[model samples]
Target chain A: MSKTPLPDDKAMLDDIAAIVEKTGCERKNLIPVLQNIQDRFLYLSEDAIKILSGHFGLSSCEIYGVATFYNQFRFNPPGKHQVKICLGTACHVKGGDIILENFERKLKIKTGHTTEDREFSIDKVACIGCCALAPAVVIDEKTHAHMTPTKIEGIFLGYEIEKEMKIREEKKRDDKDTPA
Target chain B: MMIIISVDDKEIQAEEGTSLLKVCLDNGIYIPNLCYMEGMETPPSSCRLCFVDIDGEKNPVPSCSVKVREGMKVFTNTPRVRGLQWSAFELIMSNHRIDCGSCLSRKACPLIKISRHLKIRLKPFRVGHINSGNEDIVEDHPCLIYDITKCVRCGKCLHICEKIHGRLYLTFAGRGVDMGISFFGDSDDETIPCARCLACVKICPVSALLSYERYEHSPEGSSS
Candidate 1:
């Protein structure tokens, strides 16, 4: 536990408070409230849920039940990059499971889990509605079609390089802003 | 208005739009199910055991979610339906703990009855079990005991809570493979106690939810 408060924690709380105010704290607004919270936070944190429960006068259990029933909601904080492997009917027939297994092995993390460094997280989606591109994987909103086990290593290597470049660029900008 | 539907070649007169599952059970036709509550408007259709082949449909459908129609033909014992039901049963039981010898709800457990009806033996260690991380029996509440390892995620308890209390205290937490029921709020608070209705326990298809007192004095405890 760091003594310094996270800069974003207050902003996140303000956003949550605004959403709750807009939703009017009704029992029926639970789903939409969750959707909004997830949209803001990238996932539902325990803190956010506890706040929502307080506003709605519902127990944590009730809120959790609704969240678990649906496949869309995520509890853990999302990685910087999201990797979704389509496991739809078309993809499944075209060896999507093998591709997914390959990703899991390479990332050293199971589906729905972020890497230890929090760089990437993987999820198995029912479909992206792109059946033509069987065995598809979407990384940070970019679709990679006709994926295979061999292609996964190269794809991850590309992301790693991209991350390094971004970090270098950010460091250069920070140095330029500092006094001589 | 009454409409006639043929279930297993026996023509039964049922009301229009009534659930085929309700009709079958009313007529002494057993279709195994775990998620269908009597008054629930929108059925969860989670349990795939009630699969039945209707005339003109290529694949079997869950009978609980299907409404009976006039001149409709339903085949309850078709090969495809049995195959789907068996696979669903096996999949559900794969994650379930099968320690019936020491379990409290042995005599009344619906999973046991359904398995026996399907003639499938309980093979505990055949498939890998889901580690829900809720293996410890929750004894926080004096009346209710929850052993999440035995839970089937049937949604029965959640629905019953809503029906009885107008709001649910128990709810599902997590998603996909990690999903399980969790109690909300402080369990020690006496104002919102579990109602002690036992509706959830009575409705549980497995022994996941048990009465703390009954569990202590269960059949297995006598010899021990």
Candidate 2:
């Protein structure tokens, strides 16, 4: 995957401003405003919160408290691939903890943390409503059922291989365009 | 309008639509409460300590959230009410890392008072403690020390801060069982507003929020 440069402060402010223009600056519409921000940027940026605070006539702390009260928002910049391990009641019964530990060990990052390269982030869900699958691990958008420690390694390796292949394909196209 | 309500067989007269807990406490009937403050338009029923069984209602309701009504029959110390109050108290204490001797508010801690009144231990034997998995103390604020373990999520500090400064600097962070106050300011913040407004430190029921010097002058650290 190609690495995109971080959005500049001006661009981020403009995006937030556009969202505020549609949602207005009312205090009551904070959830919708935050949701829109979350959808635009996977996680709420500090600049976005500050811009929203100014637009809504609210203090930064006040907006921050609201954003945190609901667990929906995350302040960290999201990684490209999100690995969600379901630790639901059924999943837990069927060795979900082991599966989670395996992922954490393999990634060299604990749950709710992203790798330094911003490629993978691990998250544990209370439930994904797939109890029949028991121990389920969802990477990006696809769910893998009955995940074991060996299976988790294989899956992550596959992701890395796919990523490498995509990079190689992009390099080939670039070479063709430049006519070397 | 004034309304007469019977609380634990005592006839008490209070303003209608006011908090039942306030009415009972005003009339020398003590019902344990944490979040309720005088003159709050809406009481955040976060603490869940002031449970009173009303005659008509099937379940015990938090007295702080209940409005005083005319001819209302309320039982604060009934077996059912006591059971529910104790449960709530234990629930709050379950997450609370209780250490009385080291606490800054040891002399005036509400948890101690509630435990004495409710006959429940500070570290409850009934419910196993739920680890928050966060640091015991957060010293990130420029001028304050937040003890995450001691915080009961009572919202008293939040209320008082909102009243004094039009909003809270130490607002809630996280959600569900992991929820607690999050001081949004950086440790290196030059313009620390909380230094002037120690309202949160003064208002906290469990002494979760304290001034920077509170540790040095803590009961164990200094002579009183």
Candidate 3:
């Protein structure tokens, strides 16, 4: 059966419309659905907001305000390796600042910024709830505690060497495959 | 009926509609999660600590609520997921007080530990008022203290009070900057007739909620 071809933008709008429609136009569920979209789309694009507002019968600014209000939600595409330094009460008192500085100097990136390589992105967190050790940082999902500037450097070097070694191995294989 | 999914390169079998959070835990892939208290009827996605990346999805979604599908690929420790989780973690931290050395929930808290693991940074965003030490302290209940300064407003206390304790004794009263746990007048006793269930105590992601005897019980470990 021949199917009617809808434009890419319209199809995406339709999908978003369907999601909003499924929520029954309730304001309460707006955030959750937006979250789902953000989850699927990285950042909440203006197009998605327009589609959502149109579907929910709300203003685009209202959607933007709600989107910006929650920290879990974001409006921009983030960098590659997101580094989080714990600045929670316990962590803050326990030299969380030093750890954050270590990241800034080593990665050559400031908080809320992605590295030039786009390989690392850094951020500060309130608390991940492991106050036992205080002054902690999380790289991806691995929690490192009682961090020191020296240890942070060693940790980065370890990842760097591992990454470099992998690249080298790939290069060696490529050379072997070349026609002599 | 079952779908094959990969986590950090290892494949696991999961039911059609199983959540990615459950899948990781079931397969012994411990993805750090603070808000995922087991057996809660409601899925509280309040804490974004459990964010993870899926292959087709653009951004990382909370593993606690997102379902796993057939042939799905996921990465829990990706730079993207870690960055967003850290951002969310910072949002929670900016409102919290910085007195972990003296705080009651020093060792047992998971949020602090996870933040350490992720190397979470706190650049401080303006959120709620920091305790100035001049405002009248509100310790209505003898068993617990509601220090607004220490709270991240994770809603753990509010949810526990309503869900486990029945009546909503502790509502997050006021608007954004002024939000805090407030209770209607119970009696002259200055304490709600809470069952002392300790659900709030357990669910508190930070040291905001504290029990009176918690420190006394652990004399040696009560450094904070």
Candidate 4:
């Protein structure tokens, strides 16, 4: 629930402990336990690994190893908006690299890093299997097919409007709650 | 009872359920192998160098995983087997640093031995070398100087650690091209003392894992 993954988070620790209890502690459950943690926190936190190591009676390094072995595992908390640009053969030929550079330049963050505001994160995937949509960019799991550098500005505008609406709705609800 | 198996048209007698790779090796047959050790119930099968063609199988299978059966006909050097092995070896070589002259295990290097046996060049000709991320080899571990560039992703070091310590202290982290390994000197409570056993250094085929003390004194260490 917390964006910053502190190992001392009591609520997160309890949830992780509950996950271990529900999943059972056989070595076979290692992946499932990790998956559950990742599902809950959107990433594999260091504290989660330590909890697993303590519960499973295994070393933390070994737990970390299994977690890192799979591509599905994420060690960093994802930003609010995750951008995955495809760099497969078709996409690469269609200026996927240029699109990635545009995103990095706009966000002021390098690839594989979250923006300082934690609003956006950039990642380059081998392929999204949408070769027909060459230079595909997926933001927040919504695939934007045939993306261009100029197109990124329009997409950001859309997200900004969405964020603005959500904030306004939250403010209105807060105002109503205060009985004014 | 000894079971009879025909390998390369030569009949060999071996115990039932013996690993085909071990059976072949025991009877003076050589198979280019790595990541295999005696008494291992399940070999890592990661190196994938020990491939053999058995009759009735459409594709070449790793010999280390195959158990010798009665009346089984096996071919060790068929074009298919060699082709698969060559590609696998080449892939491994692509990841390898191949600077054998500067390597500590030059004398006992298994890569050189495999290359000679396979009649393939140590340098990969098919698949170009992959840059293994970091060019700088910096290790903070007290006991070992782990050169990431030379590691072949073999689980020998991890296996040996598990066998020796009754738990996996060393582990291969990450997967695919970015995978790396780690070693813990002790457990959380510091109950188990590793004491620089150096088993990993000895077990490594290409000397990816080296003793820090030895590495410090070596010409390679002084220069680095």
Q: Give the chain A TM-score for each candidate.
A: 0.80, 0.79, 0.70, 0.75
Q: Supply DockQ values for each candidate.
A: 0.35, 0.43, 0.01, 0.42
lDDT of candidate 4 over A67-143, digit per residue (tens): 76776777666789999999999999999989998998999877777877779888889988999999899888799
Model 2 chain A: lowest-lDDT 10 consecutive positions:
A1-10
Q: Best by DockQ, which number?
A: 2
RMSD, candidate 4, Å: 5.3
Model 4 DockQ vs. reference: 0.42
DockQ of 3: 0.01
RMSD of 3: 23.5
TM values, all candidates: 0.64, 0.83, 0.48, 0.77
lDDT of candidate 3 at residue A18, scale 0 to 100: 74
Residue range B1-224, candidate 3, lDDT tens digits: 98899998889999887778988988888776766755455568877778888898877888888878888888988988887777777767766666666666677766567667777544344343344322233466556656677776677676666666555555554446556665423322433555356678667876666666663454423544
lDDT of 1 by residue, A1-180 (tens): 113435787678777887887777778888999998888788876667778888998877678778877888887778888999999999999999899889888989888788888888999899899999999999988999999887888897887798899999999999999947
Candidate 3: CAPRI quality band: incorrect
Order the candidates by TM-score, highest first: 2, 4, 1, 3
For candidate 2, lDDT tens digit of each residue in B129-174?
A: 9887676778777788888888888888878877887765777877
Give per-residue lDDT, candidate 4, residue A28. Answer: 90
Pick by TM-score: 1 or 3, better one:
1
Docking class of 1: acceptable
Docking quality of model 4: it rates as: acceptable
Return the lDDT, model 2, position A40. Answer: 81
lDDT of 1 by residue, B56-112 (tens): 998999999999899999999888888887888887887687888888776888888
CA shift of A128, model 4, Å:
5.1
